[model samples]
Target: MSGHSRLVELVPLYALDALDPSEAASLESHLEDCEACRAELDVHRNVAAQLVPDEPPAIHVWDRIEAAISQGDEGEVIDFGAERARRRGNPFNWMLATAAVVALVFAGVLVGQRLAFDGLSTDEGVVAAAESAAEEPGALVGDFLVDDVAVARVVLSKDGLGYVIPTDALDTLDPSRTYQLWVLTPDEVAISAGVLGADPGPATFTWKGDIAGFALTREVAGGVVSSAGDVVSVILDT
Candidate 1:
């Protein structure tokens, strides 16, 4: 396979913050010249953002996010409740949703094994991350993948806080486009979770309502009234 093809497979995981140091370093170097991969990487990173476990701030997160974008901050959180509430609810067709869910579950199992193999308690960061997760009730965790390869993991708390833990697989995107996350409500209406980028690790955001699942799409840089890009991934809020 060509280098781009290989890197394409790794973009999702890289976005999830699941890539090891050496592998991640190599990918970052490749990204400097490969703008297509960089854009694809942004897609995966934004999709994976939904799986992170951190909590969003109380208010004006979007204000800060816009400021950060203007100031060239690496990453920033943005609110999506209002936009989500206003959008018409046409979620992905059932078959596609089911397929994505299956892939996500399969990837989650593999990622769990990888985490275990890495030695659990020895990594203080892992332990702390777990302890942090333990504080939330009805917390949901699962893997998201592209073609059965583990790319990212999603976590949501009973209170609606969320996090996306991505691995070493992801894809880059176009500079004129941005990735947007959507939360499907129990009523079947999809709500926006805000835009996403390539600055891996964890980001925090808030949503209101009974969430049924999540979706990702690429839209114009700032975002749009409705998602125009193809649905890339879906994970029903479980």
Candidate 2:
């Protein structure tokens, strides 16, 4: 008497060995070929494995085949049903709860930012951000992801004076070459800050110079670029 049988219908009989020998054999054969049955069996086995005993038994857990066979045979069904209902309510609603929490946090940050600049005008946020950027040892060396896109975080230094971090877009590079950062000014251009490519902080160097131009362009090893890439992050501080 079957159209499409529920997996739940099979559970009690499966737990009790209630089926005849022929029926059990048929079910076993079908289970071997069925992904759904195997997955369901795996979950039940995992849950059963977690059941604890208030008083330990010396008997081997696997030796008790009756444990599974005794499944739908008792008042224990009520407890399993309650646990299943709680699990369903707990996991799915969590996504909605998390979304609401994130929205509240983002709104709070926006309000705080507005309150901070209630008196300042004309791009005060930009000014405050830049000043905050300067105070950060890493921000002044804005050599990381640009405009939310992934790129190389290059660091160049020589002779121990220190180096500069340049955020150079990697998509602009070719297969065999790399971009290099050049330190130049209105009157002089002298240090090769570094060669780009590689992430997680490029090799640190002992660099020394006034980094005026701070341009990045494609070049050969020991990088030499005639014109920098279009995605240049120029700082005209000089």
Candidate 3:
């Protein structure tokens, strides 16, 4: 039989230094030319290293391991792979596997939290702007919709300050274009609030005077003084 067929279980045992000297010597010889076994050995070795603590576990730990092995079967073959797959699983290895899975899950949660809150300061500003505008005495709060789909919320304070809170809809903007917010008056006049990046999150603008509502238009980067492109979305105060 080829090396892997014979040494599949032995490789993992050898990685843990649990194999006898003779068995280890034999496995080391096979490892010299068997790339597949070497890779598998490395994987098992890494997992074992990560699970083992720097400080030795209590004496009861050895007792539990002994009891687990004895319960598995004193006369059974010492094949780690077969033992893992056996009908009556070894509790010791199962505990180790569970611990490894928990460690991996905890690590993944930490990474996800880091990515989710990396822009905490910016998000704080968005929430603060929205709350502040909402609390203003005569703030006009309205939603900007496209094709009957709400994409952004516009808040206009009585002091002529405006804030735009973008939604998931802005994700569809073309990378080559910028979105510009305009304050439209009753006589059909549009005033530019400011030009925004393609996928802006939240923005604040100043409109000294306003009459009707707001409109969003797509324009080239470094937005024009006046919009000449098709309007993407509109919000009417009425």
Query: How accurate locally, in lDDT, is each candidate?
Result: 0.58, 0.38, 0.61
Superposed Cα deviation of residue 34, candidate 2 (Å): 37
Q: List the residue pairs that clash in candidate 2.
A: 15-69, 16-69, 143-167, 157-206, 157-207, 158-206, 158-207, 160-206
Clashes per candidate (backbone, < 3 Å)? 30, 8, 0
Worst 10 residues of 3 by lDDT: 99-108
Q: In model 2, which runs have C-alpha deviations exceeding 4 angstroms?
A: 1-140, 143-160, 163-169, 186-190, 197-201, 225-231
lDDT of 3: 0.61
Q: What CA RMSD would you report for each candidate?
A: 13.1, 27.6, 28.7
Across 1-238, the per-residue lDDT of candidate 1 in tens digits comes to 9887887778888877788977876777688788887888888878877777888775788895676466444432223334443463333444234446632232333332333212122334543453355344465555555687655556665666676554556455434456666666666555567676643343445765566677766577776545553666777655
lDDT of 1 at 38: 88
Candidate 3 displacement at residue 167 in angstroms: 0.6
CA lDDT of 19 in candidate 3?
A: 91
User: Which of the two, 1 or 2, has more TM-score?
Assistant: 1
Please give the lDDT score at residue 232 for candidate 3: 71
